[model samples]
Target: MDFYLTALVQGLCYGSLALGIYISMKIFNIPDITTDGSYTLGGAVTAVMLTNNQPTYLILPVVIGVGAVAGALTGLIHTKLKVNALLAGILVMTALYSLNLTIMGRSNLPLSNLPSLFTLVDISTDTNLNTFWIVLAFIAIVTLFIGYLLKTDFGIAMRATGNSESMIRALGVNTDKMKIIGLALANALTALSGYLITQWQGFADISMGIGVVISGLGSVIIAETLIRSLSITSVWLNLLLVLGGAIVFQMVLAFTLSTGVNPLYLKAVTSTFVLLIVGLPRLFRREV
Candidate 1:
C-alpha cells in the first residue's frame, strides 16, 4: 500500500513535466527535447538558491521564469532561424547542460538538512502522506491555471496554430509567435515540476532529468487514450486526465517492481509500455 502511494506521489511531481510535454508534442506539434535540460535547470537553480537561504515562496516564480526564458530561447532559434524545432531544442538542451553544471558548480547537490517547501506543511502524520497532500494541492492549482488558459481566446488561437497552421495564418495570426508562447509555457510547467521534486526529494542531481521525457510521453499518451475513449471535448477534463495518467504511469512502474523485476530494466519496461499505449490505440481504430 505504501509502495503504490509513494509512486502516486512521485507521478504527481513528474506530472508537471508531463503537462509541458503534452503542450509541446501534442498541441504545438513539436518534439521539444528542451525538457531534459530545462528540468535540471529548475532543480539546479532551486538547489543553489535554497543553499543560499532564499525565500521558499519566491522560488516558484523565479524558477518558472527561468524555465520560460530557456523555452523562449529555443523558440527563437527554431522560429527566427528556421531551424527544425527538434534541433533547436537539442541545441538549447546541450548548451544548458554546461550552464547547469556551472550553476551548481558540481555534479550533485544535496539538501538533506535544508528548509524545504514541504517543511511548513503538516497535512499528515506520516512524511509520505504529508508530501502527497502538498503535491496534490500544488498540482491542483497548476491544473486549474492551465485549463483556464486553454479555454481563452489566445489559447484557442495557439491550438489552432498547430491543428491548422495554414488556416490560423490565413486568419492573420502570427503562428510563429504562438509556437514560441506555447513552448515557453510548456517549459515553465516542466520547471515547476523540477522545483517541487527537488524540494520534495530533498536534493537535486544533474542526471535527474535525463531521459525523463519517456515518462512525460507515457503520461500524455495515456491521457490521450482516455480522451478518445470517453469522447471528452472539454479542455479542462482532458488536462486533468493527463495529470491522472501520470499517476497511473507511476503505479505501473511500482507494480513492475513489486513483481520483482530488476531495477536495471525499469526504463525498458516503461518504453515497452508506452509503445503499446501509443500503438494499440491506433491499431484498434484502424481495425474498427
Candidate 2:
C-alpha cells in the first residue's frame, strides 16, 4: 500500500505534465519538446524560492508563472520569429538548460532545511501527505480548471487552429497568438508539476527532466487507450483519462520495482512499455 501510494503521487505529478503535453500535441497540433526543459525550470524556480524562505502558496503560483513565461518565450520564438515549431521547442529547451543551472546557482539544489508545504501540515510521518491527498487535490483542481478553459471560445479557436490552421486563419483567428497562448498554457502546467515534485522530493536534480517529453507523450497515449469507452471526448474526459493513465503508469513502475528490476533500465522499460501500449490498440483495431 505504501509503495502504491508513493507511485500514485509520482504518477499524478507526471500526469500534470501529460495535461500540458495534451494542450500542445492534441489541442495546438504542435509536437513540442520544450517540456523537457520547462519541467526542470519549474523545479529550479521552486527550489530557489524555497531556499530563500518563500511561502509554499506563493512558491507554487510563482513557479507556475515562471513556467508560463518560459513556454511563452518558446511559442514566440516559433510564431513571431517564423522559426519552425519543432525547432523552436528544441531551441527553448536548450536555452533552459543553462537557465536552470543559474536558477539553482549550481548543478543541483537540496531543500533539506527548507519548510515545504507537506512538512507544515499535520500529517503522518510514515506517509508523505503529497502522495495521499495533496497531489490528488492538485490534480483535481487543475483538471477542472483546464477542462473549463478548453470549453470556452478561445479554447475552441485554439483547437480549430490545430485541426486546420488555414481554416482557422480564414475565420479571422490570429493563429500565431493562439499558438503562443496554447504553448504558454502547456508549459505552465508542465512547470507546475515540476514545482510540486520538487517540494515532495526535497531536492531538485539538474538531470531530473531527462526524457520528460517521452513520458508525457506516453501518458497521453496510455490515457487514450484506457478511455476508449468514452464517446464524447471533451476536455473533461481527456483530463480525467490523463489522471487515470498517470496512476496506471506508476503502478506499472511499482510492479517493475517489486520484481527487482534494475533501476538503470527504467527508461528502456518506459519506452518499451509506451511502444506496446501505443501499438496494441492499433493492432487490435486493424482486426476489427
Candidate 3:
C-alpha cells in the first residue's frame, strides 16, 4: 500500500511533464527533446536555490522562467534558422547539459536537509500523505490554468497554428511566433515537474533528466489512447485525463517493481511498455 501511495505521489509529480508533452507533441506537433534538459534545469535551479535558503515561492518563478528560456532558444533555433525541429531541440538539449552543470557546480546536489515546497505546508501526519496533497494541489492549479489558456482566443490560435499552420498563417497568425510561444509554455511546464520532483525526492542529479522524455511521452500516449476510445473532446477533461494518464503510467511501473523485477531492468521495462502503448493501437487498427 505504501509503495502504491508513493507511486501515486510520483505520478502527480510528473503531471506537469505529461501536460508539457501534450502541448509540444499533440498541440504543436513537435517532438521537443528539450524536455531532457529543461527538466534538469528546473531541478538544478530548485536544488541550488533551496540549498541557498531561498523561499519556495520565489524559486517557482525562477524555475519557470529558466525553463521557458531554454524552450524559447530551441524554438528560435528551429524557427529563425529554419532548422529541423528535432535537430533544433537536440541542440538546445545538449547545450543545457553543460549549462545545468555550471548552475549546479557539480554532478549532483542534495537537498535532504534543505527547505523545499513539500516542507512548506503540513497537510497530513504521514510525510508521504502530506507530500501527496501538496503535489495534488499544485497540479490542480496548473491544470486549471492550462485548461483556461487553451480555451482562450490566443489558445485557439495556438491550437489552430498546430492543426493547420498554412491556414493559420494565411489568416495572419504568425505561425512561427506561435510555435515559439507554444514550445516555451511546454518547457516551462516540464521544468515545473523537475522543480517539484527534486524537492520531493530530496536531491537533484545532473543525470536525473536522462530518458525522462520517454515517461512524459508514454503518459501523453496513454491519455491520447483514452481520448480516442472515449471520443473525448472537452479541453478541460482532456487535460485531466492526461494527468490521470501520468498517474496510471506510474502505477503500472509500481506494479512492475512490485512483481520483483530487477531494478536494473526498469528502463527496459519502461521502453517495452511504451512501445506496446504506441504500437498496439496501430496493430489492432490494421486488423480491422
Candidate 4:
C-alpha cells in the first residue's frame, strides 16, 4: 500500500509534464521537442540555485522564465529564420543539452540541504510530507495557472493560430507572436515540472531528460484514451485526463519494477506499450 501510494505521488509529477506536452502537441498542434531539453534546463537551474542557497519559492518563477526563453529561441528559429518547426525544436533541444551541463557545472547535482516547498509547508508533523501531497499541490497550482491562461484572449488567438495560420493572419492576428507565446507557455510548464521533479528526488542529473519527450507524449496519448469519452469539451478536462494518464503510467512502471523487471528494460516496455496503444485504434477500424 505504501509502495502504491508513493508511486501515485511520483506519477502526479510526471503527469504534470505530460499535461504540458499535451498543450503543445494536442492543443497547439505543435510537436515541440524542446521539452526534452527544457526539462533538463529547469532541473539544472533549480539544482544549481538551490545548492547556492536560493529560495524554493523563487525557483518556480525563475524556472518558468528560463523555459520560456528556451522555447522562444526555438520559435524564433522556426518563425524568423524560416526553419522547419520540427527541426527548429530539435536544434533548440540539442543546444539546451550542452547549456544544461554548463548550468550545473557537472553531469549531476545533489540538493541535500536545500528546502523544498513541501518541507516549508506549515503542517507541523513528524511525518515527512508524503510525495503524494507535494506532487498534488504542484499539479493543482500548475493546472489552475494553465487553465486560467488558456481562457484569456491571447490564448484564444494562439489556439486559432494552431487551427489556421492563414486564417488567423487574415483576421489581422500576429500569428508569429501567437506561436511564440504558445511555445513559451508550453515549455515553461514543462520546465516547472522538471523543477518539481528535481526537488522531489533530492538530486538532478543531466541525463534525466533523455527520452522524456516520448514519456510525456505517452502520457498524453494514454490520457486521451481514457477521457475521450468525457462530455466535458473544455480544454481543462483534457488537462485532468492527461494527469490521470500520467498517474496510471507511473503506477504501471512501479508494478513492473516490483515484479523483478530489469530497470534497463523499462524504456523498452514503455515504448512497446505506447506502440500498442497508438496502433490499436487503427488496427481494427475499417474504412467506410
Q: How well does each candidate superpose onto the true structure, as a TM-score?
A: 0.97, 0.94, 0.99, 0.94
Give per-residue CA lDDT, model 3, range 45-117, as digits (tens): 9999999999999999999999999999999999999999999999999999999999999999998778788
Clashes of each: 0, 0, 0, 0
Off by over 4 Å in 2: 123-126, 129-131, 227-230
User: What overall lDDT, based on C-alpha atoms, would model 3 receive against the true structure?
Assistant: 0.95
The alpha-carbon RMSD values of the candidates against the true structure, listed in the order shown, are 1.2, 1.7, 0.6, 1.9
lDDT for model 2 comes to 0.87
lDDT string for model 1 (1-288, tens) is: 888988999999988999999999989999999999999999999999999999889888999999999999999999999999999999999999999899999999999789887877798899889889999999999988998899999999989998999999999999999999999999999989989889988888999889888899999999998898889988888888899999999999999999999999998999999999989888988999
The window of 10 residues in a row where model 2 has the poorest summed lDDT is: 122-131
Give the poorly placed runs of model 4, Cα more than 4 Å off: 122-129, 227-232
Residue-level lDDT for 257 in candidate 3: 97
Candidate 4 lDDT over residue span 125-147, tens digit each:
53334556666877898888888
List lDDT for all candidates, in order: 0.92, 0.87, 0.95, 0.84
Backbone clash total, candidate 2:
0
lDDT of 2 by residue, 1-288 (tens): 777788888898887899999899988888898999999999999999898898989888887888888889989999989999899999999999999998888988999968886766554555555346767777888888998888999888889999999999999999999999999999999998898889888999899899988878888888777667566466777788887877788789889988999999999999998899888888998999
By TM-score, the better pick of 1 and 3 is: 3
